[model samples]
Each structure stands twice: as structure tokens, then as C-alpha cells.
Target chain A: MPLKSVYKLYQDMETEQSIISYKGVVSADLLTSVLNIMEDKLAIIEESVSIRKKVYNVLVECLQNLYHHNEGKGTFTKNAKQSISSDKASILIISKPADFYEIKTGNFIENQKVEKLKSKINHINNLDKEGLRDLYVSILNDGEYSNKGTAGLGLIDIARKSNKKIEYEFKPINDQYSFYCLNVKIN
Target chain B: MENINLEGTAKTPSVSFEYDNGTIELRGRSIPENSVEFYRPLNEWLKEYSTCPQPKTIFEVKLEYFNTSSSKCLLDLFKLLESIPKDKTSVYIHWYFEKDDGDIEEAGEDYQAIVPLPFKMIEVDEI
Candidate 1:
């Protein structure tokens, strides 16, 4: 896989602790594999259950976001190797910092939607835990009764767990597409 | 009602609930692929248990991990436990965490703050 080369590129960066990295097309199977790797690594850490759960939850939300917002045009067929268009491919990196785990995911987003996402993350980062919980409950109930999907609870969950501000950036790829980078620090 | 027993997976947890003794155990990881589907039966069973509860119900939650959706479901489960009459039914929650994991310990404390029930946070060795 061409993606293997991407992994090879990161192998040369000699760091104090091992840096586990994987670059691949975002799919359910790939998501599960990544979670398995993370769980295996986290198991060795004492008192990691809560952190493990938070990590798992955050990854799920990230993958689901990719799936829901995938800009790919072709339908995926069984038994057929569906090539992910360069614009549709998403990259996720989980790196262990000295004091925290840094989870970063980048994907193509429409140039127009970048501002909305940035503003949303900013707003969520400002709320306290109680406020976030109240917002979550309100959204859940409102979405359920109104039949609205994607109530933006994933961002709220991320904010609640990370307990830190979300750092993100948008790099313009072209007129129509921009690369969206989302970074969360779990301390 | 029938019992609910299932093993845990990398993204999900194991559940073993006996209707006779009302002892329910949730162990292992819990990050279900589809939180809605994974928790449907557990929620239904809890609904049933509410109507016909055992005298003493012991809930052991030894989860290494769970997603946000599962956290909501867990709160629901504890809320159900809080509903039972204190005299007719006694509920004991054993929240197990690894000794070094501060996150799990804090989670147990957070739940205790929310639910009005007898919940104990116990630190255990690696499973």
C-alpha cells in the first residue's frame, strides 16, 4: 500500500519514547484496528481505564465524523478494491507527548465550511463541564424529538473529555478543497 | 426475564447479568461500534428488572474503557438503580479501577456525585 510509505517516513524521527503512527484510509475496519492498537498500549499503563475509555470515545467520534462528511463520490462495492481519491483520504495520528496523548486527524473539507467548524470548536472550548453536560443533554433530547441527526454532540464530548482547548487549522489545498486539521490534547 | 451475557471486544465490553440473583456484571472494554445497537438490550433488561427486582442487586462495573454514548447509558442504569425503594431493594455498585488510573477513579467519584445510591470505588490490580 502506498500508505505504508507514509508510515516509513515517520520511522526515522528518533524520540525518547516510541511513537506509534498509522496513516490509512478511514474505514470501520481501520478504526477498529487503531483502537485495538491503542488499547493494547494503554493496557500496560496503570489506572488507564478512564483514559482508555476517553481515547476510544474520541476516536469513534473522529471516525464517524470522517464517514459522515466524506466527500467521495463513488459508492463502495463489496469484493472490490475501492480506491480512495486523494481528496477523500483522511489521516489520523496518535502521538504520546511527554505529559499527554496528542490525537490529530486531518481530512479534506470544503473551503466554505472551515470557519463554521472553527467557531464551533471555539464555542465548545469555552464552556465548563456542567455547561457542556447541560448542552449535551439539551442537544440529545432536542435531536431525538426533532429527528435531527448529527446534533454536534461529538464535539461536545471531545471538549468534555479533553478538558483542554481544541487546536485546529485549515490549509487551503485548492479552490474547492481545504485540509482540515483537528488536534486534541488528552492530559 | 432472560439473562444477558456477552463477552467484551476491543471496542466494546462484556456483560453478565443473572435474573435470579439480580447480580449484573459489566467488565472489559466498552467502545461499541454502534452504541445504540450495543446498549438496546441492556437498557431493555434494566427496564424489565425495574418492574421485578431482586431483593439485593449487585452491580459490578469493571470497564477498562467506554465511549461517551456508553457513559450516558451507564448514567441511565444508575438512575434506574436509584429508583428502587431503599427498603424493598438494596443496590450496591462496585466501581473497579486499576490502582494507577486516576481517570477511572475520578469517573467513579463523578458518578457518585450524580446518583444518590451506595456506590463504592475500589482499586484493583490489572485484570
Candidate 2:
């Protein structure tokens, strides 16, 4: 496997029409900074309130999931060949295409948890709009719903806001963990 | 019990509770690192407020954004306020959002559907 050069990653992002691309440790402080920058960028772009709200809302959920699920295991670096090690690693990109803005996130998860994560994504993808809403409400009201420091409403909320199927792919990085990528389209 | 009034930050919303006037307001962005921790005190305050419930209480929430964790915490706050007897206290939730933001309006509706309160969706020109 060839290593991804930092410059090539920039060029690819340029071709993909992405703005505000970050790949590294995702701390709470980073979330705030990224949100401020995203808000400024969104304001300059002059999108409708509904679209802006959707993007912002989805971004929040994505950042939360990234922060919560990041096990500090997978190397959180733009280029794995680099020796930089930042704990709590993840990737976030906001791209604007012709029709809609796409928010893509990449992170690492333990191999043991891959099956559960895949099943959750599959369940969310299979749900209709109404099903998503019901799930969101159900989890919200259930006081006992607790796992890995989340109410499990992040995915449901993301699916609900996107109004589309949540796209996700998993790749085996090693025998221990895999790289999980999620794609959310906001039109 | 003293009312809880704290300023907002870039990640957390500002909290204001006026026991005298019966007004509880949370405005600004809400995506705190630990929402349960951030909202625990407010929930405790509401529990104490129910002891000497206000006659007419108004809960105003004007948030620009909130993550899933904060969403659950907000629901907890609302549920606490909802526990106050309706006969003793008339509660109204003023959920404000940008006029063009259907997402915020619907978020408010989600809360309205779950909680038994008179939810007023206020449309504002700006967030």
C-alpha cells in the first residue's frame, strides 16, 4: 500500500471541492474552533437557513461521534507515514458540490466493535423518515440508554437531519481495529 | 433556593432563572463537553423550584445549535419543569428559531410532542 502524501491529499481535496479539511486528534477545544470556522464559512457562502442549520446540526453530531468513539488507538494523522502522534484522532471534511454540501468523517474503531457499529448503521439506513424520528424520541425518553458515554441518539439524529440514508464504509486496518468512514449529504 | 444565572460560552448556552418573575431562559449555542454535568445543577434547581412553584412560568430556549448530548440534557431540564403541577403553575415554552429554519422549529416540536406543555414556536428574523 502506497502512503498518501500530504500534498496529494491537498490536491485531492481541491479536486473534490472541500473546504475546512482536518485530520488529527479531535479534542473538545478543536470542536469549538472548527465550529467557529465552519460558521464563518457557511455565512460567507450565503446558504438558506434550513441548509445552514442542517449542515451545522449534522456537523455537531458528527463531531460528537468523532470525539466519543475515538479510542485513541488508530493513528490520527493526515499521513500515516508521518511520525506525529496526536491522541483522539479523526478526520472531518466539508465539501460543497453542485447540489448539496457533503460532510464526511473518518475515524478508527476497534475490530471487536465493527460488527455492532455496522449493524447500527444498517438499522439507521433501513429506517424511513418516521422511523428515524421514533427512534430519536424513544432514545431521548429512555433514561437507562447509556453506552460509551452517549445516549445512542447521535446516529439517529444525523439520519433524521440528513433525511437520507447514512452512508458508511469500514476497512480492516489490522487485526485489532478498522477504519470507519461516514458520509452525510446535506442538500 | 437562589436562581441559577450563568453566562454562555462558545460551546455552552447561557442560563438564566428568575425565581421572582418565573422566567427560565437558555440562549446561545449548547454543545458542552459534558452536557449531563453542565445541566445537573439546572435540573437540581428546577427540582427545588417545584417545591414553591411559580404561578405562571415561562421557559425560553433560543439556541443556535446543540449536539445530541445537550439535546438529551435539554429534555431532562424540560421534564423537570414539566413535573411541576399544571394546576399550581401554568407553564409555557417559548422556542425561538430563525424564521427560515424548519429544523429548529421541528426540534421544538419534538420536545413539544414529548412533554405536556404549551409550546409556542416563535419565529425570529435572526438566530
Candidate 3:
């Protein structure tokens, strides 16, 4: 791959209105730093306390989901070739493109898991605001935790809090893996 | 039973459970990476406290923010509180949210609906 010029990278960020963008392994320490940076940034750009809280809440769910779901170093597809970079490395970009702010995250997942995740998000997207709230409460009351200590409420909570449809796409990395990309909009 | 007084951190909340006074308090952000692990001690403490709880138990939660995992763990915590026999200890919950923080306020209302405990919603300048 040719190395992109620094100027071009800067221009890309500017064009996208990206305030913070990172592509690497997601870690606990990194989650803290990212949240802190966004907190400072949101404090300045957003004035309403309710909206700020909504954005911050959605951010916590998105970053924590990435931290938990990241598949550690493995084979990933880049340019249709088997490339072994930190396959666990994910991408996060926070931008304000228009009236709303967008949080975009991409991570690698086993191809087998794609169908279930797709169904889950589609189910959430179909729900109205009231349905989303009921689902969140029901899951919370169910009191089940995955091995990673998640309650499976992240996406629902994100949707309920943001009041927006979550945008997503899955690109096949290989037969073994696919990249799961999620975009959440907060106004 | 003894008291649990834990300091708050960037990812977890500060917990104070006074066995004698029956004041159970949790204050701070609760975005722990492993919320189940972080809350295990409190769950155990509540289990023990339930055996001979104080006459009037007051549970207080003043969280600035929490992730979805923490939210479930909190429900688990409340379930434990609900299990305490009312005859032994009259339980009351004080749920605090910062003014204008509609998300937190609504979260408190949601818990109040499902937890089966008398909850007093308190709006404060900050928590």
C-alpha cells in the first residue's frame, strides 16, 4: 500500500468534520482517554445538558461494546488479501457533519456471528421509542450476563437514548471473518 | 455484618454500606469494563445484610453515568434489595439525578417501575 501524505490525511479529516479518529486495538485505558477527550469536546460544542448527556451516554455504550467485542490479533482481509495486522484493531470516528453528531465504529467479527448481530440490530431498528424502552427494561430484568459481563443491552440502550436508527454494514474480510461497522447518530 | 466503604474511580462507583445505620450509598460513574466483577462484593455484602438487616434500610444511588452492563448489575443489586423481607427491614430507595439530565432521570423512573421498591426521585444541581 502506498503511504498517504500527511496533508491528504488532514484534508480527509477536515472534509469529514472528524473531531477524533483512531484506528488501533481498543483497550480499557484507551477507552478512558477517548471518553475524556470527547467529554471536553462536547462540553464546548454542545450547550444543552440533556443533549450532552445523551451523546456521552451513547459514546459509553459504543466504546465499551468495541472493547468487549474486539477479536484479538488474527487473520483479517485487506484488499482481498490475507493480511495479519492487529486484526483486533478497530476504528472509531466521532464527527459532526450536520445538525447531528455521528459515532462510527468498525471491528472484525467471525463470519458465523454476523447473522445474529444483523438480526438483532434490525429488530432494534424496527422498534418505536416505546418498544425500545420496554426491550431495554426487559433485558435488564432478565439479569443475564455474557462471559464478558455484558447484558446485551448496549445496542438497545444506544437506540433508545439516541432516538435514531443505527446505521450498519458488514464487509466480508474473508470466509472466516467480516468487518462489522456501526454508525450511531446523536442530535 | 460490616460496612463497605469503597472509593470511587474513573470507571467504578464509590460504595458505602453501613450495616448499623442501614445506609447503602453508591455515588459516581459506573462504566466498569467488567461490571459483574466490580459489583460482586456489593452483592455478597447485600446477601449477608439481608439475614439481619437494620430496621429501616435506605438505599441511595447517585450515579453521573453508567454503561449498559452496569445498568444490569444495578438491577441485580436492586433485586437483592427487594428480596429482603419487609417485616424485618422497611426498605426505601433514594434515586438522585442531576437537574436537566433527562436520561438519568428517566433511568431512575424505569428502575422504579421494575424494582418494586418505594423510590424517591431527587433532582439536584449535580451528583
Candidate 4:
């Protein structure tokens, strides 16, 4: 990571009206505390019941997705070599941009998975409301669980609740790994 | 039949299935890390309840927050209720949400549409 790019990232976050941002290992216990803290923060800022719920719901999905698939931390993809140097780590930023709250999450992933993930996200972004809802129903009933016993519903749930398209970028860190970043918005 | 009462924690819901009252209420937030493990016992209890369900079993769900994993467990619970012969056990799921919380109402509708039963949406001041 270059100094200029890091500085640019900092400036971007600074202007996005960030409520909170965190980096490092994402554990189950950490998720519990983060959710509690953010719940209180959301209650104080938003008076509309629906917006608060939408933001909160989307936040949970984002955090859970990080906890489930972040490179070496989660018990997904048994064949991939264990990554070193903050590969288990993920970043979370809750920001208020314009009329919507953006939950931005970044985590390291095996480079080979970039195309698969990009396709999945782009497929979700292209869906109409009805398509998303129908997809949610089928995914829920599909009974497919990851090795960690997660139902793989985190991303779909985020897309269903989020009224806006999910934005993302896959920045290659090395030949072996890349940083998968996603920005989901709620109105 | 015996009652199934479990206290809520920071990451789990409070469950109270009183056999005497024929009422089952699930309240509070449910965001357990391993939701499948946390909800397995409840599903087993529901299995037992199915064998000897009351004439009229009423489920009152007043959850403020729950994860997608817990969401699946809830659907499983509703599906179990749908299995019991209506003539033997008339099950009614009352989904309570705080007023102005359209998201919860939408969640309830999602469950209502899937489960064939008299699932009512009730608004409250708070849970």
C-alpha cells in the first residue's frame, strides 16, 4: 500500500461523514459488541423507525459476511493456503453519505475468487425488486450451508433490504490475494 | 407437557413456551454467532410440542432484531406449526412490531406468505 493511496482512503472516509470505522480481526465476540454499540448509535441519529431498522439490518448482514468469508479467519474454503499478515482482518465503516447510510466492508480473499465474487455481486445488482425477493425466498429454502454451517444468506439479505445497488471494488494486494470491498446503502 | 423457558442473552432471544397457557412468546434480539446450535434445542422442543400440542397454540413473536440465520430458524418454527393438523392444534402466529417499524411488518409478511395460517400483524408502542 502506497502512502498516497492510504492518504486518499483516509480523506475519502473523512468526508463520507463516517460514524465509526474499525480494522483488524473480526471475531464472533467482536461482532456482538460492534452490533450493540451501533444499535445505540443508530437509535440516537435516526428517528424514522424504518430507516433505523434498514440500516441496522444491513449492518448485521455486512458484519456477518465479513465474519463468515474473510480470508483466513472464517472456516470457508478449506483448500486455500492460510494467508499471513492481516488476511484474517477486515474493515468496517458506517457512514452517512447524502440521504443513505453506507456500510463499507473490506476483507482479504484468495485472488482466484475475485471473478466468482464479482459475478455474484454484479448478478445481484442487476436484479429488479421482484427478482431479488424471489431469489431471497429460494436461497432461504435451498438448505445449503457453508462448511461453517452458515446458510449463505448474508449477501442476499443485504441486497433485499438495501434499496440501493451495492458498490464494490477488488483491489489486488498480491499475486495470491486481493482486498474485496463492498459498499451497501440503505435509504 | 413441560414448559420450555430460556432466558435471553446479549446475542440470543428469550423463549417462553408455557404449556399451561398454550402460549409461546419469543422476545428481544437474536443475533447469536452460531444460530443453528442456539436454535436446535428450540426446534427439538417444538418437535415435542407437536406430539402433544394444545387445542389452540398461540405464538407471540416480539423480536426487535434477529440475524438472517435466526430468520431461518423462525421459518422452520413456522413450518413446524403448519404441519400440525389444524383441527388438532389451531396455531396462530402474532407478529408484534413497534409502531412505524415497517421493516418488521415486512418480515412478518414474508413469513405470513409462506406459512398457511392466520398470521396477524400487531403494532405496539415498544417491545
Candidate 5:
């Protein structure tokens, strides 16, 4: 962490035309603040009410997914005697690079959970608008809630609203954990 | 049965279920961190209301936006409303959406498809 890097970070955000960027622990209170801020920002940037509503709806799903999945704190053994701590903090960035708004989120997840999540997103990505709507309704009727009260419909809802394939990646962090990043574009 | 009137917040909706009149209302946003906890009491209240409901029950949902989790809870509420015997009580649901909000309109349609309750979609200038 150097003094000059702070300026560089600011420059990068400006270059991306970022509306808002946040990192660290994601909690319910923080989610409220983020939503309020985004509502105000989108109100100014987007003139059409429908597009604003769509972007706001998609943003809610994305932030909630990040909050539910963030690990917060974890430790990994580096060697026989040394250990490294991983802050499993989550990240959210809303930027407008072109005509569309780009929402990017990142969080830590269990390594074993990577394949299942990847496959789910892939399945959602492969569906057309009508197929996605059917899947969403079926899941809404039959899907069981997880311990965290999520019904596994977040990604599907995001796909349906954005009308675009979800872009994601899972970067292995250690034997037990991986960093998951999701990027969604709303036009 | 006792009535329910909860104030709306930034994350949760305002609810008013009058047991005597059978007028149920849910308005505003519903994206609580724990949607289950927030909607559990309402679900229970609906279950109780079903046992001896009024002649005609009117349930109005005028939500600006709701997350996926809240959507599931809302469906649960609708199912309970659907369970009430039609011979005993007839339930009417009015799903409200703001102008140009297709997502909310579509959501109402989705619920109408699953639950056999009489649903009316109403569009307005604002919510």
C-alpha cells in the first residue's frame, strides 16, 4: 500500500466511468446503503423508467448473492509451521464503459462448491428468454430453500432480466477455497 | 383473530391484514436480509385467517420491487390463500405495478399461473 497507488486507483475508476465501487464484508445494512446509493445514481444516469427498474432489480439479486456467499474470514495453512489468513471479503463495482451498465461482483467460496455453481450458471446461460422464464417459474414453484433462505433463483432471475449470458470465473485460491467473480451487463 | 399492521421500511413492506374485514394489503419493497423471518408471521396469520375467513377476502399486493427470496415467501402466502375453501370464502387478489415496470407485471402473471386465486393486474403511474 503506497501513497501513489491511491491516485492510480482513483484514475482507474475514472477511466472506467465507475458509478460506485465497494469492497469488504457485505452485510444487510451495507446492502441497504448500496441500494439507496444506486437508486439515486441510476435515476440520474438512466432516463427510461423501464431500464432503471431492470438495472435496479438485477442489482438487488447480485448484491444479495454476494452477501449470502461471502465467507468473511478464513485461514489456510501455508506450510507445516506457518499459516496465512484470507479475508474472504466481497467486492461490488458498477461501471458504465459504453452503452450498457456493467455490474461486477466477487466473493470467496468453498472449492468444492465451484463446479456446482459453475454448472448452474452455465445452464442458465444456455437458455433462451422463454426457456429462462419457464425455468424461473418452475423453480419458483418447486425449489426448496437453502439454510440461508435462498431459493437458487438469483442467477436465473438475473439472466432473465438482463437478457444476456452471465459471465463468471472461479480462481483457485487454495486447496479449500476459490475466489468467484461474476460480471453482468445491463443495457 | 387479531389484526396485523406492520410499518414499511426501506427493505421490508407495509402489511395490513384486517381479520374482521378480510382486507389484506402488502405495499412497498420486500428485499429483507432474512425474508423468511420477515414473512413468517404474515404466513402464519394467513393460515389462521383461512380457517374462518370473511365472506370475500381481498388481498392487494402493491410492491415496487422484491428480491428472489421474498418472491418465494410471497408464493407461500398465495398458496395459503388458495387453500381456503371456495365454498366458505372467495379471495380476490389485486397485483399492482407501476407504469413501464414489466418485471413486476410478469411476476404477478407468474404467481397467477401457480396459484388458483383470482388475480387482477393493475397498472398505475407510480407506486
Candidate 6:
């Protein structure tokens, strides 16, 4: 493929109405900086306290997932190389409209993990509030904490609060990796 | 312990507790950056309150939304309420849900089923 064509594809993939977008290595420091900037922007919008809290939580969960799960460096485990660019990094975008705030994060994942993720989303989407609560409790009791102390409840919490279907897409990046995009909207 | 009063943040809920009256109110959204740090003191206050036990204790939960972590903390609070002596302390839990928010209403009911305290599910007009 020509260099120009590849560049065009990259740009096209990034097309979005991003109030805040970060493309590079994901780290706690970088995430904090982005959150600080976003908080200032959100403050100016004068959203209600509840809405503001929801937005902040959603952003934190998205960014932390990217930082912890991004399969970069020598850790080429599973479907790492295909979706995420070991050299290029991941992307996060926060957009706002009159009615809602949308947060989107894109990172690379293994092809094998896609099916499981899709199934999980489907299961969550099918649940009512009580079902979601039961699932959360069951998961809490069953699942071990991640290295970062995450209980794997982030997605469930997102689903519970959002009360909306999570939007996602997977684009083939290579043989082992594929770009994964997850979007959550808070109104 | 000193009274716990924190203004609500975008991700954190507003909290006001009076040690004297044993009256506490939690309102707004609760998805705190550090759930443990945010809830620890409140839990402590409840524990202390259980010992002295005010005659009338009312906990007004008017939260619009909360995440799973916050839900766990809430369950802890309700359990504390269950432990208090009924005669010495009369606990009234007023759970407020938005009129149109069926999810919140249902959640309130679920809590009522588990908690032994007198729980009332009240609907509030939408903002």
C-alpha cells in the first residue's frame, strides 16, 4: 500500500467531533492531564452536578481500561499486534452536544477477545436494573481483582448508569490485532 | 467523630451527617474517583451512631444515580441500619426516585426488600 493511502486511512478512522482527543501512549499522568482539561471544559458548560459526576466516571473508566489492557511492548500476548500499533498508540475522544456527552475510546485487542466482549455487551444490554444488580453482585463475588485492583465491574457499572446500549466497532489492524472502539453516552 | 460534610462533585455525591441528631442525607450522583476514601468516614459515622443510638434517625437517599461501587457502600449503610435497636432507634429510610425513572424506583424497592428498616419509596418530579 502507498504511504499516502495508509495516512488517509488513519485520518479517516479518526474522523470525529472530538472536544478532547489524545493519541499516543496511555499512562496515568496523561490520563490525569486529559481529565483535568476536560473537567475545566465541562465546568464551563455548567452541567448539573449529577450529570457532571456521570461524565467524569465514564471518562475515568474508559481511559483506565485502555491504559491497563493495551497490549504493547514485549507483551505481545494474544491478539496484540493486529489491532493496536505497538509504535503508534491508542485514541480517546470526548464530545458534547446539547442533550448529552459522548465518550469514545479506541485501542487494539486480540481477535479472539472480540467474541467474548460482544457476548458480554449483549448480556448486559438484555438485563433489567435488577438483573444488572444481580450480575454485578455475582461478578463481584466470583471475579478476582486485576493487578490494578479493578474488579471488572467497570463495564457493568457503565451499562447500569448509561441505561443505553454501548456502541462499538472492530477494524482489522493486522493478523493478530484489531482496533476496538467503545462509545458510551451520558445525558 | 467530626461531622462529615462534603459538597457534591460531578462524580462524588453530596454528604451531610449530624452526629447529634443522627440525621444523614446523601444526595446527587455517586461515582467517586476513590470510592473507598469517599465512603470510609461515612461508614465510621454510622458505626458510631449505632452505639449511642439517637431516638429518631432518618437517612434520606435522594441519589439520581450511582455506580456499582457506590451500591455496595449503600448496602453497607443499610446493614448498619438493620443492626440498630428498633426501640432505642427508629430508622426511616426515604428513598427518592425520579417520577419517570423506573430503574431508580425498582432499585429502591430491591433495597427495601433486603433492609429491615422502615423504607419508603417516594417519587420526585423530574428536573
**Which candidate should be chosen as best, given DockQ against the real structure?**
3
Ranking by DockQ: 3, 5, 2, 4, 1, 6
RMSD in order of candidates: 5.7, 3.2, 1.6, 4.3, 2.0, 5.8
Question: DockQ, in order, for the candidates?
Answer: 0.25, 0.73, 0.89, 0.67, 0.88, 0.14
C-alpha positional error of residue B21 in candidate 5 after TM-score superposition, expressed in Å: 1.7
What does candidate 1's lDDT look like per residue over A121-172, in tens digits?
A: 8888888988876776666434431121233577787877787788888887
Per-residue CA lDDT of candidate 4, range A51-163, in tens?
88888888888888888887843344424675346558899989997877989999988899999989988898899888887777777766666677577777777888886
What's the lDDT for residue A185 in model 4? 82
Task: Give DockQ: model 3.
Answer: 0.89
TM-score (all chains, Cα) for each model:
0.73, 0.91, 0.96, 0.88, 0.96, 0.65
Model 3 misplaced regions, further than 4 Å: A1-4, A76-86
DockQ, structure candidate 4: 0.67
Write the residue-wise lDDT of candidate 1 on B47-94 in tens digits. Answer: 888888999999999987665556666777887788878876799999
Determine which window of 10 residues in candidate 2 chain A has minimal summed lDDT.
A77-86
lDDT-superior candidate, 5 or 6? 5
Candidate 2: global Cα-lDDT?
Answer: 0.84
Docking quality category of candidate 3 according to DockQ thresholds: high
Which portions of model 6 miss their true places by more than 4 Å? A1-19, A24-90, A94-102, A108-119, A125-133, A137-151, A160-180, A184-187, B98-106, B125-127
User: How far does residue A129 in candidate 3 sit from its true spot (Å)?
Assistant: 0.9
True contacts kept of 4: 0.55
Query: Which residue runs of candidate 5 sit more than 4 Å off their true CA positions?
Result: A77-85
For each candidate, what is the lDDT? 0.72, 0.84, 0.90, 0.84, 0.91, 0.75
Q: Quick one: best lDDT, which candidate? A: 5
Question: 4 or 6, which is superior by DockQ?
Answer: 4
| Model 5 lDDT tens row, A59-124 | 999999988877736677768987646574788999998999999998888888899999999999
User: In Å, what is the interface RMSD of model 1?
Assistant: 4.1
Tell me the interface RMSD of model 4, in angstroms. Answer: 1.5
User: Which residue pairs collide, candidate 6?
Assistant: A53-B10, A53-B11, A79-A110, A82-A177, A83-A177, A83-A178
Better of 3 and 4 by lDDT: 3
For residues B1-127, what per-residue lDDT tens digits would candidate 6 score against the true structure? 5678889976678999987877899998775535656788889989988988889999999987665556667877888888988887999999998766655676686677667778888888852
User: Which pairs clash in model 5?
Assistant: none
Clashes of 4: 0
Task: State the local distance difference test value for candidate 6.
Answer: 0.75
